[model samples]
Structure formats: structure tokens, C-alpha cells
Target: MINTFKKDDAQALKGIAIIMMIFHHCFSSTELYEKYTISFFPFKENIIVNIAVICKICVALFAFISGYGLIISYEKKKATASRWALSRYIKTFSGFWIIYILLAFVNIIFRSRFLKVYFGHGIWIGIASVFLDFAGFAKLFGTDTLLVTWWYMSAAVVYILLVPLLYKELKDKTWIILIFSMFFLRVILSHTDAGSFTGSNSIYAFIPVFISGSIFATTLFFSGGY
Candidate 1:
């Protein structure tokens, strides 16, 4: 397919989506940065749920944008892509653990879950699970969740794992199937779970979102002239 969507518009929409995610996570508003941003939308409990729905779209959309950016980056240089992939995996693993460590230290020092408010449990076990996502321990061990955003990083790891395959064989049809399957699965899971599939929502349900990101990344490759 031709690059029909306006590049500028897509970029703008991506910007909007990111900002929305930030707001949804931070203040749980699409843009609680300003008082008037959600002035039109009702500000009730249910309304907040509605706002979060829109924010989830922003996250899914951001995953797509991430895929778009990464695929294009890989296409530009093979050696660079390989290095980038390794570096990304290392970065994600290290980054998650580093944050987990800091958060655990802070929690031990403060003896408060307030830091836990944003992140989550951060003992040694949480530290390991948060970074490695080695769920093998999550059942026996506990979760850290110091930064709720760790979920995003966890999802990123999954998307990264698909890069080699996407760059090689699945760049075309496999990606399309992933995109469709994920979208459909998301709907099914959402209805069954009564919405919300972030952490432990479905025995680690980042697969759909991760693949969706790949689909978005594929389009970016096309639009980027890669």
C-alpha cells in the first residue's frame, strides 16, 4: 500500500498519543496538565475510566510508533541494527533493575509504599522480576512494580525480541497477522477481564500490544522510505 496517511499528521498524532500516555499515567487524565484539557469530558469515576480508555489507545498507538521507528533504524544499517538490538535488550534489562534497586533502597529507607505507589514492590525478588521479567519467580517470589511504567519496558522487551524475525522473514505477512490477531485478542480479553490488561491482567498479556507495535513499525518503515 502507498503511504496515504499524512506523515506530518501521523507524527502529530504520535506526539499527542505520548502526551496522553504521560497524562494518563501521571494524573490519569488525557492532559491533566491543564485544567481545561478535560473540561469537555465529564469528570466522574466512570468518566475517568473513559479517559483511561482513550489513553490506552495512545499507548497501543505508541507501541506502533515504536515499531515504526525501530524497523526503520534497523533497515538503515545492518551492523548498527544488530548492535542496537543487543544494546536495547541490555539497556532494558539493566534499566529496569537499576530503577528497581533504587526504588527498593528508597522503600527500605522510607519504609513506605508511597514510592511503591508509582513503582511497586521492590525487594530483591521484585528487583529481579521487574527487570528480567523472569516470571518463573513471580509465582514463588513477589512483584516489585516500583515503577508502573516497568510494564511498558516489559512490553518493549517482547517487541524487541521480534525485531530480527521482523527484519528477516515476517516483515510482510506475519506482521499483518500479528496486528489483526492482537487487536481481536485485545477485544476478547478486555470483555472477559472487564477491561484493563496491564500487569498480571492475563498471565502476561503484552504479546498483543508488542505485536501491534511491530505492525505499526512496519508502516513506519514504508512511510519512512526504508
Candidate 2:
């Protein structure tokens, strides 16, 4: 009968998401099948690919957990919302940038095919592309990301920037906020080149699920559901 989402629940959801991510990345595409040494399934390859495709929900799971955990933690912290968000922004990007810089270094040093493919023609354009990727705006601005998986970075930035700004408004009006997020997501999908599944790098595409998590947390904490 306990419906409360405790910190342990959040961590458990995260663990599940991570496992799904690994499965999705490992078997999602047939092109990469050659990279793996073993395939236990003797049936059609599409079966595994289909299962992997379904595992793409991992992104939504992670987003939900992020929204839920952020609201829960924010409610307990003594710092102002903006300050808390700033600290989170710094922490997230600092960790990301370390790996980003290292990857960029290796790419440039080796003149990897990634640079050749998405560098966007000229030197200035290439630099701009790199800058866009670094700032996590590549997907937002319709620029190419240096790495395919980095599309999530843009979504992460959007989520981090939005949570602090909307958490209070979502406190009592969770349903209203959730509806608005869904409407916003639909609008973005209708008008833009944003896609679903792996190409859903745009925050507008996934904001509803993210806000759903926040609403769940708000309900649990404020409605005596705990």
C-alpha cells in the first residue's frame, strides 16, 4: 500500500534505465551486429532489433527519474531554486565537459571520420559545429553533434534549465503543467524537424514524460500519498 517514491525507488528506476540503455545500444541496429561476437537468438535478427528498439524507452525512464528526483531534492534543500539549479547545471556540465573535451581531443588528434562527416564544410563552420556540440545546442540549432549519443546533451540542458523555473508552478497545478508540457511537445513535433526515438533530441519532444515524473513526485509529497 506504500505509494511513496523514495530515493531508493528513484535509484532503482535509474538502474533499470541504465540496463535498458545498454540493451538498446547493443542490439538496436543491425549494422553494428558485426561488432558483437555472440548472438544467442537463432531466430530472425529483426527480433532482437525489435526488442532493442522497444528498449528505447530507457530515455523516457531516465527523463522521468530526473524530473522526479530533482523536484524531490529541491523541496528539501535550503538554497534558492535558481541557486540549486545553477549548482546542478555546473555539476552536470562539468562532468560532461571533461569527457567531451577528451573525446574532442582524440577526434582532432586522429582526424577521425566524425570530423570529416559533420564538420559542416568550412573551418569556421566546423568550429561553430564544435562549439554548438560543446554548448549542447547542436540539436537545438539543427547542427550536427560530434557523437550520435550526444543528442541527449541538448535535452539535458533543456531539462536542467526548465525544472527550477517551473517547479513551483507545478506544485499545486501539476495537471495543468503536465497538460501544457504535452501541448508544447506536440507543437514542436508538428512544426519542426524533430523526430521520435533516437532522433528525439529536442526537449519539446520529451517534456511531457519529464513533467509526468515531476507531477508524480508532487502528488506523492503534497497529497499525503506517502
- Which model scores highest in lDDT? 2
Clash tally, candidates in order: 9, 0
lDDT of each: 0.57, 0.75
Model 1: what TM-score? 0.58
Residue 122's lDDT in candidate 2? 82
Candidate 1 lDDT: 0.57
Off by over 4 Å in 1: 1-14, 26-49, 80-83, 91-105, 112-142, 171-213, 216-222
Q: What's model 2's lDDT at 226?
A: 22
Which candidate should be chosen as best, given TM-score against the real structure? Answer: 2
**Candidate 2, position 59, lDDT:** 91
